[model samples]
Target: MPAPRVSVRTRIFELEMVLAGAQPPVRRRVQVPGEIDLAVLHEVVQSAMGWTNSHLHEFEIAGRRYGIPDPDWPSQDVVDETKGKLFRLVEQGDRFGYVYDFGDNWTHEITVEKITGAEPGVRYPRCVSGEGACPPEDVGGIWGYEEFQAVMADPAHPDHDERLEWARGSFDPHRFDLDETDRALQWLAWRPLAPVS
Candidate 1:
């Protein structure tokens, strides 16, 4: 018999969370297509959060990526819903900030900011969990967040001056206006939610 075809669908949902320093609350949601395979979906999220396939599955969202598994997260269902919503929010903006699974319940919260430059000044620093560099070691590339920050902070370090200069350069905060907010909401308001089979 022929194999049964797998069905996939994408849905958007609005997510609201109370951030550390913000009053009221932070609200935003993005539409993400659902995947037939939970493993694949997990991989995509892990990649976005700077984890490679080799890393052990730990309920921690630190080390380069902001949203990993945390101890204080809500139930699994709520966490999944929050993650899906946050993904869409990040995809929509030029730059965004997220704090996931911070407190009990592993709630993932994100803030999408507006990008001003012609080019999106966003950087996805991949985590180096001892993965063999794709290219041979000869070629140099950008370092991960920890390494980069360390180098930039240490004035005595060789790359500190250059890294510091790069960090100091002026950049616009990617904040959305009322119209963009409405658009994001509309997108999520109409999205369909279904459990992954």
Candidate 2:
């Protein structure tokens, strides 16, 4: 008998995620295993984009919401994200939305760019490229981020010194390191999670 053929569902998926309304368009290009769950995908995104994961998040695909459903809000109708597989739920060219921090409303547009077989000896999920630093957590929304940029860039601005102090002297809005993000991912494709209640 022949060796079991590699299934397409076991391949790799290249995705591009862009933070909506960022000035220069903060974006990340990542290659993730198709079999990984959306819950793990959330981790990969957080690591790749330099987010601290300090607030609630949700994914909306094909008009359905996925996340850790809240018992207190039973009407939200969110499916458990941990149960959704990437390959099974999406295909090349599909687009979805991810919302983080309901108050700040940091939204990301995620596109499935390509799907191909996994490479031997290579990590399953890694950041291939990216641009722009994530705005500080609770930097407000895009408008607030714009305001932050203005104040941070103008030392003469009244809030400049205080903003600098908050950012620990300086924050580079355009800084993005592929190696740093890749290193942070480790083997996220196989990461384990406790059962969602």
Candidate number achieving the greatest TM-score relative to the actual structure = 2
What C-alpha lDDT do the candidate models reach, one value each?
0.30, 0.86
TM-score of each prediction: 0.26, 0.90
- Which stretches of model 2 miss by more than 4 angstroms? 1-9, 187-197
Q: List clash counts for every candidate, in order.
A: 16, 0
Q: What overall lDDT, based on C-alpha atoms, would model 1 receive against the true structure? A: 0.30
> What's the lDDT for residue 140 in model 2?
92
Q: Which pairs of residues have clashing backbones in candidate 2?
A: none
lDDT (tens digit, per residue) of candidate 1 on 3-65: 222223232221222223322222333222322222333333333332234432322222224
Candidate 1 residue-wise lDDT at 159: 82
Please give the range of 10 consecutive residues that has the lowest summed lDDT in model 1.
130-139
